[model samples]
Structures are given as structure tokens and as C-alpha cells.
Target: MDAETLPPHVVRTAPGQYEATLPGGTLRMSMRQEELPLPEICDFALRHNARRRFLFVSRVLGRHMPTRPAAMQDVASRLADKISIDPADGPVLFVGMAETATTLAQTVYAAWCRRGGQGLYIESTRRPTGGPIAFEFVESHSHAMAHLVHLPSPEDDPENLFTTARRVVVVDDEATTGRTALGLVASYAAWRGIAPESLRRELAVLARWMTDAQSTESEFTAFHSLVEGSFEFVETGVFAEAPPAVPHPDRAGLARRGTRHGLSHPQPLPWQLDVSPGHRILVIGTGEYGYQPLLLAADLEARGAIAWVQATTRSPVLPGGAIGHVRSFPALSGERHTEFLYNVPEDHGYDRVLLCCEDVLPPLEHPIHHISRLEVLPLPGTLTS
Candidate 1:
């Protein structure tokens, strides 16, 4: 149906006995095989940015649930197809949404580099480390206001990366109404002092299951028309919520308590203020467990702690710094492995440090150097409260 003719909500079902409510009629989703002709560039973006959650049921990656790396690659490949850039022209900056999309965006960077492009990746964050912020924006739909993005060198020429790019591709897992992408693009455009038309921009997602064609059209018309550009989508997968699974040891305890706490009880931890009228708190999230920290941070803020939030991820940065988000972090296994280095920034420090993990213990070797205080909260299965 057209965008103007669609309803406010639509629903869909899946083979896993799950259902998804969309803007149109409900669609039945299953582990069925579907293929389409895609360019090598697009494939690269998809492979790099794809998440385990997006894999086909029969695929090898889906066999035991794909690694975060594999899923991230898939997402990146898909994004590459949406926007093309010329690296020799200038550097690209990639900005990823906090929490879920951090790694996916990083994957986009990786693909761009492989294509001989130079780029930088940054995600909106809430953890405040008492540093000067390069820029700040608002996420209208997010629970928190004030998203902070720190640029490496403010003195650098913006034209090379910000203005010279052929196009900017905003990456996300899904685009419901397209409001988030519009917000991001507008923020960047306003800050860069470049007309939105000066930069060709697009959006890439693994799924595009909006309520109707009209909804999609209206969203694009609202944003793209303002920016004076066009937009496109790749795999238009339907959205279907999975059925709840039996809780594992790591989550059972927290799940039970969460239910008792009214799903909003576990408040965010307080931020240690080092300066008066303290700066905003920015919590840099880690991996799939990042949401827990996000919720905790939000709770802390609700309880009167001044804090903001963001996440680090495995997504690659591409030319113009476009990338999807991914789930990757340094495992505290003392192995000195690659996966262990992703999120452990060398000078990383905070006023108050809070860590959330499943059954894993905090890495003792790291020695909470950047943090003034450290609090560790094990998964719900470990404690009643």
C-alpha cells in the first residue's frame, strides 16, 4: 500500500513462532531461502556489517549463531553498496549509533580501508571523562538527551573529509520511520557548515520493514527532500519479534529481578563528579551487554546522577566515516588476543567506572587506571537483587 494509505501499525509472524507488528498487515516470516543479485561492493558491506541475528537459519554462520565479526562484515557489505566514495579526495568520518550499532559501524570502516579509503569511526556517547567535547547533538527518541561526539583533531581541515566526500551513508540495523537518520544527517550538516546538497547521502540497513510504502516515502521525502538528495534500501526484510527463550544461567537471575523491579528498577550507577556543575556523563558501552550498562546509566540519571551514554563497537569506518554497528569487545581472558583489544582504550578513564558482565570476572591486569572508582555487577543469575 502507499505511504498515505498505510495504517499506524502492521504485524508479522515468523517460523520461530514469533510475530512482528508493522504499519501494514502482519507478514509471516520463516527460515526460508531467498537470494538476489548484488554487487561485490554491496556484498562486502553486508558481510562486514551483518549480525548473527540477521543470518539465514540454514547458513553456516547461523548454524551455531555467527560470531560478531562475521555478522559485522555482513552489515558493512550492505552499506558499501548504498554509498560510494573516493578516498583520494579526502578522509571520511563514520558515526555510529550508541549501544547496538557500534561494532557494525566499525565493520564499515574496515571495508572502506580494504578498498583503500581513509576514515575515522566515532559513536555518540554518554560517559563523561572531563574532556572538552568537539561537538554535541540531541537524539530525540533516545532516553537520554545530549549525545556527544569527540573528534580527534578539531584543527584539521573539515573540507577534506566533511565536504570532499562523494556521499555519506548513514548505517543502522533497521529504519522504521527514518527519523533517526534524518536527525544524524541534520546534525552533521549543521556542524560541518556544508549544505546537505553538497554531500550525496544515503542510508543502508539489513532490513527495511516500515509500516508501508507511504511511510517509507514520507520519511524519505521529509529528510531527503530537505537535504536535496535521494535514498535507497537493500534487503527489505520483514520485522518479526522472536519468541522468548528459556533464560540461561547468566540472565535468569537478572531477568527475575528485572521483572520484580518493574523492568526499570535497576537504576544506573552514579557518576563521580570531579568538577562543579559537572560536565555531562558519557558511558561508553561494551559488546552485547552494553544495553545493561545503558539501562544502569539511565537509572542512575533518573536517581539524580548527571550522565549521558554511548558505546564502542567492531564496525569498520569507511570513507566519509560511514559504517554499521557491531558487537565486539576485548575478552578478559588474559590471552592478549585481538578480540581483547577492541574496547580497552589505552588512556580510557572515567570518574566512576561500572562494569556489567555475564559470568566473566573483571580483568585484574587492566588495573582500573582511568577510573576513580570501580563497581562490578554480575549478571542476574548470580544475585537475587
Candidate 2:
């Protein structure tokens, strides 16, 4: 059966009254939905990460035409509240996690920066084809071991961008254990010689879904107070653990379909093509669809194509030199007509450019059109062929 014809239990449900069958007994959730309007909190927690399972499937950012600026603002405002810093407290450095959270983090940074404080936006990325690296680190669960961060020169730093800025807001989609943020704090503290307690660092996310038992909030606080100085976290509602594994007809069918096609059934991307052996292909993704493109790029690499992936987002670029994980590329829209300028020289000269995501479209003036063979990969469920 097609995914759409699957049983109701297989589809995602709205956050409201719902019945779920558990191992020992039945579980139900009955609570009034409360809206949280903190911009930073929303940006970091709600929108930063993409939906992991079938339980949640909506994409919040520019994936749809009407970009929710208010949603972005709500997250930024909450993050500011957590830090207890005035919106005008100079420029704040906003660093986003890799892949999915890049745009969401960038939005929070823009909101924070627009409020009289300069905003410096940086996102983490695993693609290492081009761009100068200012720093590098490792993400435990990621397939890529090395993450490269690119910061602009000090000359490009905005008036408010400074290493000694009172607040450095670290934004992620979700803070499950707060370990990622804590690791970030430890890195900054060690580098600056500021006690974790003395270093004014704040953490924010779109949702604080992970329970305290799963997170290191208490441990982080204790470590900072004992090892350094102080740190704080601002978040929305704590999330409960996802429902235990229930039979998913859609996933199972997809798995079966893959085996028939000689593809790795239900595993990320089944169809992989080697554009050319040893040739590097860059697949750029849109906001919400970033992770899928990254996965496909990796799969293509495994199939013998040197692949690099990056994403374009709606977040405003800050006038600073501090770098984040993902590299900011230009979108094809608007008056500049310089969108193709952001394409990496090493990437543009590739044998193929497999553009993924439903929203990504070729530019009118694509530089690669004349140089390389371009192909489009339609996302599942929406594919006609």
C-alpha cells in the first residue's frame, strides 16, 4: 500500500489528546497547548532541528512560501530572556549546530542582532571542499568526524562583535542532554581562560523536549559553578520521550520497495549515482530539507563520487568575522542576481550537480549549467516518476 493509504496510527498526529498503547499499560496525554513567545527559545528549540520520526513532520522555515518571522522572533526573544541581557547589549555571537539547525540558529542571531546589538551568524558544517577554516571540532553521532567553522576576518567584524561580549548565545534545534552546549561552553571557557562560571554563556533551543534525567543541566550548572563561574539555559516545555516503537506500515513498505529496486530499502537514499569517479559533486539544500540532501550527498560519496553538501537559508548575514559551522551561500532569488557567485569554484567544475529538496530550483543564470551536467532528485511521496 502507498504511504498515504496507511493506517491512521502510522501518520503524525497534532499535539493534543491522543491514545497510545504502551508495554505494561495504555498512556494518554491531555494538556492545554500553551504557546511560548520567546524568540530565542522558539528559534533554538522549536525550529532549530528537523523532525526526527513520523510523529512530527512539518517544516517551519522558508520551506513554505510564508516564512514565519514571528516564529523566528519568538525564539530569539526567549533566548534573550534566558540570558537576562538587554537586547541592546552590543553584538551577540549566534552559533548554530550542523545541517538542520543552521537556518533556525541564523534567524535567532538576526533577531538578537537587529535589536541594536550586532548579530554575527555562524553555522557548523561537515563539508570540507572550500572556505578557510577558523576552527574544527567533532560531533559524536554524526557520520562526519571533522566539522569546519569559517569566520570572516577581524576587519569584517561588526562594531559589536567582540570576543569579550558579555553574552555568547549557543543555539541548537533541541537540547536533549545539554551535553552539546556544555561541550561548546567548555571549549570557549578553556580557550578564553574564563572560568565556566565567570564566562557569561547562555543556551537556547526551539524546544526543551529532553527530560532533565536525560540532560546534563544539573551537571552543567554544578561544573560551571565549581570549575568556572556561571552559565544559564533558556527553553520552552520539556519534551517527553517519544512513543516506543510501534509498527509503521509506511516505513515497512518503503523498506520492501527498496529491496525490489536493488536499493538499500528504507535506508536514507537508496538510489546513488557516481557522476564520475574522483569527481566532487556539491548538493546544496534548502532550509528544512538540509539533512536529507546531506545524507544523499554522503551516499553518493560512498558510491564513488566525491560529494560535498551545504545549505542556503533565510537568516540575514551579520557583518562580523566570527564563523559558525555551515557556510552561508546565496539564494537564487532577489535583485542581486549574484546567487551563482557563492558556488564553490571546486564545486562548479564538477561532472554533476544533483540538486535535492522540493523547493530548490535552478537559477536563471547558473554558472554550472555551461560547465557540468545537472540533475534533479525529487523527494519521496512527491515524486511522479
Candidate 3:
């Protein structure tokens, strides 16, 4: 098999240090594994949050960057290959961190299904429900901190999903400090009235990058990933007010529910992007819902156009190092909030740029300059049907 190519901006700076340049700014990342190249898996980006200074933007996540569906599926498949499922390990429960890795985790569960294995897919969300809250945890570094785990209905055997499972496989796009996972396990420990050290866990981590200070208190039998390493974020002392962000955890929850039970909600305005042969296009999905634009990108790709998909985020990051550049825009909700896209280079422009949002329409002027066409279309249910 031929080795795939890494993005041009991915460069090794020094021993255990690599720089990933995106349009936002260059990120100086620290890695523990010399064998795992940074660019092949992910790139570094600065974070805009007051608590954290940087973000490790994923390339295959099909979230921040536009990627093909097949490629995204391949990543999940590859990650699954690294995990060894033993019948002796007993029944397992797969937990996907909300918003970002929900889909990635679902794909992993799908992989298990292929092997005729059984597992219940559980996800952590910021959304609340009238149902009982299984547990709640905070993603301290994220723009939104509160995450709630609501179990499925009793008819689906929610009790069995938790009690019968001997292990919890937590999945996330990448681990920066690993505190998020720690918080998760800690929350789980409290919910079950079990000691944190007593849980049998296996981290099906995507990017297993952890700093020296990261928590490793685990009963996990295995740690698996397509790549493993860490990055160093150097903040420029640049501070600013971010745009108003809507977690829309409800939409994320609905999508997961829809996928499981074949339910579909009202979609945002149905808009079409006219594509021509050999056009390099970009479709941007707003907030936590990237699945819609992902399907759009797939349609564009099937039509012979080189279509790429990415999403807008409320996370604050400083520019420089790994991120080549940063572009800011008025939040879709209004001027009250600010949104950003990183790693866009001045040199590489697209033919068409399409914006898809779940709830609000963003100002269309800032991100893509000199593009032949720019269209702002509200995603299904985000606007008039």
C-alpha cells in the first residue's frame, strides 16, 4: 500500500516538537512519540478560551476540516483495528464525548457491529432532558463546560446498559490534558458509587496525546489510537470577547436519537450549490452538526467535484505557530457572538464556499475572500422549511 501524503504545513520543528500551520496561526505542539508524525493524523491550533491557550484541530475528524466520508470512515476503521476485544473482557459500554466525537464514536460502534459484537452506544451531552440524568461532567477547556449523560428509555434496557457492562470505552477526537477523560471517569465513579480505581476501562482514544501532567488513573486494560503525542500552546497574550455560542446540545442529541430510531427532524432551508466538473468547493457546517454538510460533501464528491467539508466553532484560540491564519466573522446568532475558522491559507482559495448552520446564519463576508461564489444557506430546520 502507498503511504498517504501529509498536508504541506506539517513540519517537524525540533526533537519531539512539530509545527502545524493553518490559516488561523501556527501551533507549536509537543509530541511524545517520534514514530507518530503529527501532520499524518492532526495539526495544532490556538484556542480562544481563557482557561486554555491552544487547540489540536483534527484533520480526519470531519469536524474542523473538510474531509471525505470514506476517509473519515477509514479513520474509525483503523482505530478499531488497534483494539482487541476479548470475550473475557465481558460486556462493554461505549461512551462518546458529545458535540465533536459523537459521530466518530458511533462509527466505532458500527465497527463493532460488523464483528457481530453487541454494545450499547452512550454519549455525553450538554443537552438536558426531562428524563433522569445518569451523570454530568465538565469539559473544562471547552467553550461549554456542562455535559450531561441521559440514559435511553427503560424499554431499551438502560439498566442493563450500565450494570451489565464491565468496561467503559470513552472516545474523543483528541486528548490535550486528558482532564476531560478524568472528569468523565470521576463522574462515572460517583454515579455508580464505585471507586474510580475499580472500573475496568480501555481508552479507545483517537489522538492519544497527553502532557506529563495529564491524569492516567485508570483501570483500563488497553490504550489505542491511530496516533499518539502532545502539543505545546504558546499564547500571544491576545484576548478578545468571543461570539455568543449555542451549544444546541439538543440537536446533537436528536441526531443521535434519529440515527438509532430512524427519526428525522425539520431540516434547515434546503439550498443547493451548483457544482461543475473539477471544482474545489468547501461546505461549512456550523456548531455541533456536521453530519448534514458531510452528506452534502459526499454528494458533491460523487458528482465529480472535489468537495471539502468543515465547521465553525466558538472556541477561542490565539494565532501563530501551527495555525497559519485566522478569520473571524459575526456569530450566526447576531453581533453578540464571534466565530472563527483556522488554517485557511491565502494561497489556496476555493471555487465555491457554502455555509450550513443548524440555528443561525453567519455573516458571509469574512472567511473566504476572492471565491467565485459564496452562499449562506441555513441547514434544514435552522430556517424556513
The most accurate candidate by TM-score is: 3
1-385: candidate 1 lDDT, tens digit per residue: 2323222221222222222222222233322212211111111111222221222111111111122223334545545544455654344555555434544554555565566555544455433223444556665433333555544333333334444444555655445466666666666777777776555556655444333432534333222110111122234443344323211112111111121111101223333323323323344443323444444454555555555443333222211101122333343322221121122233334455455543345465554323445555566454321
Question: Which regions of candidate 1 are displaced past 4 Å?
Answer: 1-68, 87-91, 154-166, 212-385
56-145: candidate 3 lDDT, tens digit per residue: 667777665556666766778777776667777676777778668865776676666676666666667654434666777778667766
Judged by lDDT relative to the true structure, which candidate is superior, 1 or 3? 3
Model 3 stretches astray by more than 4 angstroms: 1-10, 13-36, 129-132, 154-163, 215-219, 230-279, 299-303, 319-385
Candidates 2 and 3 compared by TM-score, better number: 3
Q: What lDDT would candidate 3 get against the real structure?
A: 0.62
**Model 2 Cα lDDT, one tens digit per residue, 52-87:** 211111123322111233443354455544443355
Q: Which ten residues in a row have the lowest lDDT in candidate 2?
A: 222-231
Ranking under lDDT, best-scoring first?
3, 2, 1
Q: Which candidate leads the pack in lDDT?
A: 3
TM-scores for candidates 1 onward, in order: 0.42, 0.45, 0.72
lDDT of each: 0.38, 0.42, 0.62
